[model samples]
Target: MKRTPKTLLVLALVVVVGMAFRVSWNALRDVARAIGADHTAATLYPFVVDGLMALALVATLVLTADARRFALRVLGTYTGASLVLNYVHGLVPALHGASVDWGRLADWNPANWALVLLATSLPVGSIYFGSDLVAKVLHHQPTPAANAEKTVESVSNRSMADQGEPTPEPRVVNAVPIPRPVQVGFLKPTLPLKPMPAIEPVPARPASTVAADSVRTRRATGRVPDVARSTRPKRTPGELLQEARAASADWPDAHLTADRIRKTVHTSAEKARGLRDALIAERAA
Candidate 1:
């Protein structure tokens, strides 16, 4: 069955703990034997709990890149699996051994069942999780906006007419007199068409234009007129500044505060007042 991370973790815990309990049971069995406690059955109970515990623990986690962790996991899995297998062999000695159990045999141990399940299951869990992880990692992204735009442009531009005009229907004209099927064979066909005019390539012009182009290219003109220099100087600087500022502020966020932009009349008045003040100061000096 397909196992998820949650299932694996739970199963691993169950297997590990169950295997540990089995190990304790094996010890108890040995002690019971020492005390002469009867464990008489169809076969001997297997005592391989250490191996099963290790296997369960290893299978629990082996996906990480850490080699040390991986090694430990591998060791644990091997030992645990061996314990589970050995326990099965011990419990059902008749299966491995030549003789059959004289009495009825228990199908399997509950603790052993848990160990076997976890020891083998971790790999399946890892594979399922790893496949999804790899797929997500290697997933391809969609075409970018620029690439999609280019494709759209190319697709939109393609035209059948651009390639060539459509083929016209073939015209078959029989002599107007032929109205019968058998008599049509003798009629001469007349195809109406305009004779195409023969084309002649154009002769090149005299080299004077080329010379004019070269002169245009070689001779640098005087400094072009500076658009910033105002011919109408009488129009004060404030008026020009606003116009210049408006033209210059062409970009998206271009703005100006209302209070700072006064009309040229106010600036001119201020300049006149300054001149008067300067004249008064000069007289006092």
Candidate 2:
């Protein structure tokens, strides 16, 4: 059960205590009246007076904090017994024409004022204590508001304790949104393509110039320089004959004729003939 502040509980306790005092005082007065010589006591008077006293004492004991359950039982018995006894006593005396003197009641004193206060508070105190006792007996639970307050208090405590420690960073959940596909139709290009430009031909270099370039390239590349082409319209027979003879060394002796020399040397017939004759003379020598 959620604990409440002691204020209401204390108030209820005070009321019950006041009621108990009132009841005890009433019981003691009844016993004294029955015992005093001024009042002639009947045979059952002592027992009735003492019984009320006993009940009042028990009520006082039950009204205490630890004995709430018994309070209800004792209070019920006392109320029932007291109601019957007081009613009978008042009625019998009234029927005998012994009604209370109102003039005597008007004669006020400190004790009378006190009694009046006690009488007024008795029912109020009884009601408060009775309700509280019933709730306790029935195991009345705390309301949601009370529970909520308790929960808040507990949470605040936890937060205070956690304040001294490092707070963990909130977890970052990587929710990658899916890309929506675009729905587009294929469209033809509107721009026209231009025609390709025609390639122009370059003029050929002279044979002499080409030869010179080749000679220079050969020299630079560490290669034997080739024989330079003659500017003379007529070719050298000796030079052709020497080249043909050197080239024909790889051929059989029977293949070394004037026609083969002409084809191999790519020269005139006279030169080829002279070349072939030179080769034969060289073989004979």
Candidate 3:
């Protein structure tokens, strides 16, 4: 694939995001360890914080309206929490496994207690906020069964309206109607129909006389006469070919196509083709 400007920009974005996430992950992991999380807990702690942030970010993009606002709130909360933890890790070098005084925070100062509370509560908050965000997203999305039921209800309502029937109350359960055998009864006529008069049989005539009569009847009715019954004498193939040759003798070779020959000779397409080929061959000779 050709590398367009958009593709290049997206690649650059992905690279930057991956690098940023790696840096954040390391800082958050260190912060988790500093907050008294054990080895396994510290390792998984970053995922809880950073993973919730990532989920919120995706939800922000995928969701819209009120849902999107909720996702944005979740994303901002996690982002701020991660930043505070990372900042604390940087400020207190003692948290980075350095030989330093824990005696400063040991005095049970309210500010120090608040800081400790904030660090411990972040993981719990991540869990609560993440669950709520996921639930909100799921709630916005309509399930297939719900959609099917709505469709069924709408169709049933429309059909009832068209038939001029009173609309029924909506059913709580799936109301797909069962197929039942319909009994169709035929009604007998209340009064007998008038007896049809007997139709007289048409006397057959001789073929030649019948053809002449049909030709005359067509002419009287202003309809085109049938070819078989017309007064004009039918010409043989040889006669038609002779007439075509004479008629197109002075015409250009371009005008001597089968369609033109057929119109000029008033003959069948097959006969016209044969006549046109014969004329062309004669000219060549």
- lDDT, candidate 1, 1-285, per-residue tens: 556988999899989878776655553234223222245611132233343334434433432444335445555554555445445546654533434333222345575456445434534544553344344334524437779899888867989766577689999988588565666566776975568999999988779987887778556678867895666557555554545355434423222222222242234545544433433344458
Pairs of residues at least 3 apart in sequence or in different chains that clash in candidate 1: 51-79, 51-80, 52-80, 54-76, 55-76, 55-77, 55-80
Per-residue alpha-carbon lDDT of candidate 3 for residues 116-209, written as tens digits (9 for 90 to 100): 6776888898889899888887777644787899988877777555758667998789779989976545666688768999999999899999
Task: Show the lowest summed lDDT stretch of 10 residues, model 3.
Answer: 98-107
Worst 10 residues of 2 by lDDT: 98-107
Winner by lDDT between candidate 3 and candidate 2: 3
Cα lDDT of model 2 by residue, 1-285, tens digit: 335657778689879967765654444334224223134443234334334434445444434445544664546654564454444334334322324342111135664354334333344455565455555545644347878998888777786566577778999999999999865446555777578999999999999998898888443565555556555566576677667868998888899889888888788787778788888888889
Candidate structures ordered by lDDT, highest first: 3, 2, 1
In model 1, which range of ten residues has the least summed lDDT? 41-50
- Model 1 TM-score (2 dp): 0.24
Identify the leading candidate in terms of lDDT. Answer: 3
Each candidate's lDDT (Cα)?
Answer: 0.48, 0.56, 0.79
Please say which candidate is ahead in TM-score: 2 or 3: 3
Model 1 has a clash total of 7
